[model samples]
Target: MADTKTLAEIEQRIAILRDNLRELVEQAAGFSGAANEELTADRINEQQAELDELLKKRDAMTKS
Candidate 1:
């Protein structure tokens, strides 16, 4: 069983990831440079994957 502290930390991490992902998406949309755009797109994908994992972790913690 996860303790309340651990659960809280997971929730906090989720929130931060969500915020970061949102910013990355917004930045990617406006990015114009070809090379920079590609880099930004890659970053967006990476952040999205991290967000998904954190969400799954949070769900599992709550369910247990």
Candidate 2:
């Protein structure tokens, strides 16, 4: 049988993925030109919030 992961484990993986996405977003920022001046903290925060919600859901699943 395949190895099983508890809910906590899943949440940790989701958090790691979020961090990777954040790093990618930061790297992409350097390439943003005048055409894309709308990149702001709010956008990144929104992404973070989305990731947080996903992690929360993963955590909740483990409670079942």
Clashing pairs in 2: none
Error of 2 at 17 (Å): 5.2
Per-residue accuracy of model 2 over 27-57 as CA lDDT, tens digit each:
6677566544355445666677778887777
What are the per-residue Cα lDDT tens digits for candidate 1 across 4-61?
Answer: 8988988888888889888988888888999989998888889889879878888888
Off by over 4 Å in 1: none
How high a TM-score does candidate 1 get?
Answer: 0.85
Once fitted onto the true fold, the runs of candidate 2 whose alpha carbons sit more than 4 angstroms away are 1-20, 28-38
Instruction: Give the Å shift of residue 50 in candidate 2.
Output: 0.5
Provide the lowest-lDDT 10-residue window in model 1: 54-63
True-vs-predicted CA distance for residue 33, candidate 2, Å: 10
lDDT of 1 at 27: 89
